[model samples]
Target: MQLDATDLKILQQLQADGRISNQELADKVFLSPSSCLRRVRMLEEAGIIHHYCAVIDAAAVGLEVDAFVQVTMRRDVEQWHENFSQALQQWPEVIGSYIITGDANYLLRVRARNLKHYSTFVLERLYKTTGVLDIRSNIVLQTLKDTQQIATSLLVAE
Candidate 1:
C-alpha cells in the first residue's frame, strides 16, 4: 500500500476534515473527482482507512467524570490476557483499555456521571474482575487534548 504525494495529501486533508466534499478533495489533491474517488476506495480496500466516526463530548452527554484506572494483575499469562481482553470489550463503560510497558498491567479509561457512579463501578465490577491483584484510579481534573489522529507528515519520510 504505497501512497504517492497525491494520496498522502488526500489522506492528510481527510484526516483534518472528513466531511470535505469529493470535488473539494479532488481540487486540493489535484486529481479528477473520479480519480480521487478511486484512490479513496483503494485506501479503504487496503485497510489503510479503517473507519470514520464522529467525536462526541463526554461532558456534554452528561458523563462528566473522566477516569483512568491502572490494574496490576496477579501475573501476565496468555490465557489471562486473552480472557481479560474478551471480558473488557463487553463492558461498555470501559471506554478504552491499553496494555502498557509499566508497573500496571493495563490502563483503562472509564466514564461515569460523577464520582459516586465511578465508585459504584469500581466496587461492583472492576474489583470483582478475576486475576486483578490491585487497582488505582485517577480522576481527570481537565482534558487538555485528546485525539485519534496520527501524524501524516511521516508518510513522505518513510
Candidate 2:
C-alpha cells in the first residue's frame, strides 16, 4: 500500500500503543472513530500492519541472561535450512532467529536462567539440532536500547 502522511500518522500512533482505542486514535489523526477503525482494518488487510504482540521481560521469569549466538552450517542447502528453522521454531527457548548478512549463516537470540542453563542449551539442545557445524556466541552485558517500533521518519519517507 502507498502510505501517505495520514496512514503514517495512524501507524506511528498505533506503534506507540496498539491498545489505543479507536476513539483516541481518531482524535490524534483528526478522523472520526469509525474512520480510524476503517483505516486500521484496511492497513491490516493490505499487510502494511502485520500483527501486534506483547514484549515481555525475560528476567521476570527466571531468565537472567541474554545471549546472541552465531551459527554457521556446512552448507546452505534448502533441507538444512528448513530442518534448522523447524527445530528452532519448536524450541521456545530459542526466542529469535534470523538469516542474517555476516560470516554467520544464522543469528539467534536466546534467554536462559543462567550460565548453567545456557551450557545445557548449547551442549544438549543446540548440538542435538541438525546441520549445525559451528556456533559462536556473545553474551549481552547490558541492553542500552530495545524497541519494537520502526521509525516513522524512515518508513514514511517517499
Candidate 3:
C-alpha cells in the first residue's frame, strides 16, 4: 500500500508503542478511532505490519551468554546446507541464524545460561552436527544498542 504522511504517523506511533489503545493511537495520529483501526487493519492485510511481540531481556531470565557462531559447512556433503538449516530450527539456544557472504556458510546468534552451558552446546550439539567443517565463536561482551523498531521517517521518503 502507498502510505501517505498520516499512514506514516500511525506507523511511527505503533512502532513506539504497540500496546497503545485505538483511542490514544487515533488521538496521536489525528484520526478517529474507527479510521485508525481501519488503517491498521489495512496495513496488517498488506503484510506491512507483520505481527506483535514482546521483547524479553535475556539476562533477566538467566540467559547470560551471547555468542555469534560462524559455521562453515563441508562442501562435499550432500544436502549439507539444507540439513544444517533444519538442525538450527531444533536448537533453542540458536536465537537467530542467517546466510551471509563471508568465509562462513552461516552465522548464528546463540544464547546460553553461562560459559559452561555455551561450551556444552558447542561441543555436544553444534560439533556433532553432520557436515560442519569449522566453527568459530565470538562471545558478546556488552550490548550497546538493541532495537526492533524501524525508522518510519525514512520510509516516508519513499
Candidate 4:
C-alpha cells in the first residue's frame, strides 16, 4: 500500500510504542482519534503492520547464549530445503533462520542457556538431521545492537 506522510508518521509512532492508545497516537500525529484508528486498522488489514510483540531480555529469561550457525546441505534439492526448513521451524532454540547467499545455504540464529546446551543442540539435533551436511557455529560474546523496528526514514523521502 502507498503510505503518505500521515501513514508514515503513524507507522513511526506505532513502531516506537505499539501499546500507545489510539487517542494518544492521534494527538501525537495531529489526527482525530477515529481517523487515527481507521488508518491503523487499514495498515493492519493491508499487512503493513504485521503484529505487535514485547521485546524480552534473553538473559533475564535464562537464555544466556546466542549463536549464529551456518549450515551447508549435501544436495541443493527441493526436498532437502523443505525438510530443513520444517525441522528449523519446530526447533525452539532456533529463533531466526535465513536462506542466505554466499558459501552457506542456510544461516540460523539460536539461543541457549549455556555452551553445553548449545553443544547438545548441535550434536543431537542438527548433526542427526538427514539433509544437513556441515554446521559451523559462532557464539556471540556481547550484543551491541538488536532491534525489530524498521528504519522508516529510508522509506519515506523528504
Q: What is model 2's C-alpha RMSD? A: 1.7
For model 4, residues 14-115, the per-residue Cα lDDT tens digits are 999999999999999999999999999999999999999998899999999999999999895559988888888889999999999988899999999999
Across 1-158, the per-residue lDDT of candidate 1 in tens digits comes to: 98888888888988888889999999999999999999999998999899887888899999989999998887755577777788788777899999998899999999999889998888888778777789999999989989888777777764
Better of 1 and 2 by TM-score: 2
lDDT of each: 0.87, 0.89, 0.94, 0.93
Candidate 2, pairs of clashing residues: none
- Look at candidate 4 and give me any clashing residue pairs: none
Quick one: best TM-score, which candidate?
A: 4
- Which scores higher on lDDT, 1 or 2? 2
lDDT of 3: 0.94
Winning candidate number (lDDT): 3
Q: List the residue pairs that clash in candidate 3.
A: none
Which ten residues in a row are the worst by lDDT in model 1? 75-84
Worst 10 residues of 4 by lDDT: 76-85
My TM-score estimates for the predictions, one after another, are: 0.91, 0.92, 0.95, 0.96
Off by over 4 Å in 2: 76-78
**Model 4 lDDT on a 0 to 1 scale:** 0.93
Q: Evaluate residue 1 in candidate 2 and report its C-alpha lDDT on the 0 to 100 scale.
A: 81
Ranked by TM-score from best down, the candidates are 4, 3, 2, 1
lDDT (C-alpha) at residue 136 in model 4 = 90
